[model samples]
Target: MEGYKKIIKKLLFFNEPKKMERFVLKETSSKENRTEDSAENNAEKDKQYRARRRKEPGGIRKIDRGTDESSKKEKEIQKEDENKRKDSEVSVYLSHNLTSMKRLYNIPMNGDVVIREFDIILKDRAVGAFIIFFDGMTDRKVINNNILQPLMMLSSLEIKKAEEDIAEYIKKQILPHNQMKEFTSYRKIMDEVNFGGCAIFVDGIAKAFTGDVKGWEHRGVERPNTELVIRGPQEGFTETIRTNTALIRKRLKDEDLICQNFEIGERSNTPCSMMYIKDIANESLVEEVAKRLKSLKVDYLSDSGELEQFIEDSSFLPAPQIIATERPDRVATALTEGRVAVIMHGSPFVLIMPITAEDMVKSPEDNYVRFPYGNLFRLIRYFGIALSLLLPGLYIAITNYHQEMIPTDLLFSIEAAREMVPFPSVIEILIMEIAFELIREAGIRIPGPIGPTLGIIGALILGQAAVAANIVSPVLIIIVAVTGIGSFAAPNFSLAFSFRILRFAFIIIGAMAGFLGITTGLFIYGMWLVSAKSFGVPFLVPFGPKTANAFTDSILRAPIWKQERRPDYLNPKDDRRQAPISRGWMDNGSKGEDEDEQ
Candidate 1:
């Protein structure tokens, strides 16, 4: 062994340390010398190469080389040219000549852009004028009767002063349209014209007058198809934002309910209205909402849903931070609660923000019904939420890991139902759940009257066939049916969808680790809820943080008189909704007694 060790040490150079060190030092010194010589040779070669290049005819020296400088100057010139092109692309101011206006509108190229040029006969002489409007957008009757008839036929006869300014005289005495504005920017004129309005441009004037002649077809206010209620007002919001705001105004007559209009979407130019009670809502909350809305850089926001997605606090969260409803009463209620409602044009749904879990779970009918029944239904909804989210998971856990916990008779029946089924409980549940979801989606996409019927028939036939074919067990069918019912019971559509997504997650976890996995999932879900914020308000507000006053109205509908304060979580400016003793007349009963005695 010692001889073998000595041989290994010799091979590894561990024996004779001084000799090894000497060898390494000599090699390093030689390498350094070689490197120095190579560097010197490279320097001399570079100097010679430069000298040769300089001696060649028409050869440029290093300092005189202009390739990089020329390229940089070329880039700068291109950048400046691009900036100039962009500036030139900006819309020009309204011109004095009718031909210029026609060219600006691209009259010959765009068939929809109509430029009706006519002679404006004044007392002194006839002046050239034109009206530009988009076809099918503007009301032709208003243009002809209000603008044209007054300017062409009436102005010539009415104007007596021969020296009066033609544009000013026509605007003051001729145009009778209530909504008219004088604008100098052609961009503003185009926007107005695009929005179903007409712009009147004069022959020698640099300014144009625009009138609101929007009379395009829109669906009228109808009963809400999604959020149906029996006791509350049946009127729902229409696609037209003006009509929707009017519906809210009719319900909420309070002058303090302020509706601020904003035009978003560079391409779509979709109108949005932010409604809040000025004196009651928190100023910061209002400002924050407005700031976020203004910060959006999207070009086309088609609906409130799209707007909500753009401005919502978090995109990854399954739960919707805003509540969208077509019911005007719902918007009115939200406004009274110190929450902001965003009403978008072309969408019937209005988005209510800074929403909590309780808000999503509570139906609009909760306020209309008696408090006792409302509270009862609210409790039932809570149960439904739990059932929808956790029931499938619990079933999988119990059958797989806790079968002994089941009662004997029920266990026997469950076993008998599963006898012919070939798949496991989790697989069976997943099959039924996926099948039901497909049916639901098909029902929504399928046209008219047949939708609901098809959903029912599809579910019934599918469930029956699955059981008979021993694909999914009968007990799994019952579980899936109950889960579907529970999902439908959620008041908010977005909240329902979130629960649907979490339901699958719970099922997978439960199948892996049984009840332990389910408990862990619930804990993580609760933690996520506690941490999530909706527009600076906690998602689990008044519950995790424990607001005493707000707790009474959450998950339980208190009497209308008892709910005398808005949600404290909102930090409302005006907290008190009503007097402490709203029924003071009952206490002061002498007036009725005196009348009876008399």
Candidate 2:
């Protein structure tokens, strides 16, 4: 050990201090000489690089190469600051406004951006002005008749007030458009133009007028294709954000309903509306939702689905933390329950957040049906959820490890069916699952009525073929078919997807350790769910934390009159949604007293 230490010191140059010092000094001297030569070469290279940059359109010159990078960064920062300040507000000079607008919008190069120059012939004098908007986005008839014709030809009298701004005069008197909004900031004007609205900038005025002439073609409100109901309002949400908001407003006529607009995605600048009841929704919950949206730094959010992913609590968890639905009625119902609704432009699906697991299992048809009928449907859905999540794993465990659990005749039948199968139970189940998924995907990819027809025919033919070929046993095919049907019964699409993924995990676990492994997975999943939160509200709400109204409203639904209070887990400002005597027609003496006692 002593000899080894000594040898290590020698190799590491620790023992011979003088010799090591001398060698280090020699190396340092050589490095200094090499650095001096490299410095000269670097300076020459910098000069050549600067010369090349100077030839480019608008490059700044630096006096010293040593401060080149720092100077460049400082200049960039100053230039950006100046531009922002200059373009922050509208300018009086029409030429300057024209130049800024052109540069900001990449005019002439942008095929759709139209700059229609016109003169608003006032009685005093003609004022130079221009309107900018995307060609396909703006309605030509509205622009030509409501705006251009009135502004150019209908100015019979001049403004008597000398102090009144021209932009204000034009907004109040000249234009016949209803949705004209005056903006002092160029950023606001630009945003209006991007959203299919047009901006009117006039000379001798330091303000701009924006009109909402958004006329881009969109789908009409139709029966919800994905979530069809037999006994409810058939109108689903459309891609246009304004239309979706209108549908909600038509249902909810309360003055306290507030809809605040937010812009997400730095480059995309997609418009989003966050809505909640002013008196019912908790202030902190509203702030949390806004904070999450404002903090998202993504460049593009294409749909509400994408926005859901950004604001959800946990990304890796199979269960979705937010609910996305295509029906406008559902959005209205959620808002009434003190939930926040996030509606994004260009997507039919609207997102409702801070929801419990029980919310996902509910159907829109529940309210229209009788209380007993609704309760029956809820039970059926819960049973379907159980089958979708655990049926395959249970089947695998029973046949492979818990044979005694099965009856004698059924067990013998299962055995006879699997006699010709080459793969084990696990592999056999996986093959059918994958094949079913492929069929479902292929059906979706094919468009029109053909999609559903193909799905139905394909499933039947595929299952029959697999059974006949002995690739899978008849009993396994029945299990897979039942599982697929149960997954379809899930009310929310996201919840269905989560169950589909967990089904596979459960299958693998049960295959390895039979029923015990399956039980362990469920235990861990339940624990995780108990701890998970949606914007600070417990995910498993009444079940996990044992909150109020768990049984009355969650697992089952009481009569409409019996549900007098909102879900207390939300901590809404006004938890009492209705008075004890909700059924005004019924005599309140006995029923109201009973409710009060509870």
Best candidate according to lDDT:
2
Candidate models: Cα lDDT each: 0.82, 0.86
**Local lDDT at 506 for model 2:** 97
CA lDDT of 165 in candidate 1? 64
Each candidate: how many clashes? 0, 0
lDDT of 1 by residue, 1-598 (tens): 9999989888988544455444453232233343444778757745654444332112212222332333333345445543333233212223434554565566698898888878788656787777888888878898899998888888765445442366678778788889999887656677788888898877666677899999888898789988998898899999998899999999999999999988898668888999999998999999999998888777898778899999898898888999999999988888888999999989999999899878899899998999998989888898988999999999999999999999999999999989998888988898888999999999999999899999999999998999889898888888988999999889889999999999999999999999999999999988988999888899998988888679668877678888888899999998888888778896468678888899
**Candidate 2 ranges with C-alpha deviation above 4 Å:** 1-88, 158-165, 588-598
Ten consecutive residues with minimal summed lDDT in candidate 1? 55-64
lDDT, residue 358, candidate 1: 80
TM-score for candidate 2, residues paired by index: 0.86
Candidate 1 residue 265 Cα shift, in angstroms, is 1.7
Clashing residue pairs, candidate 1?
A: none
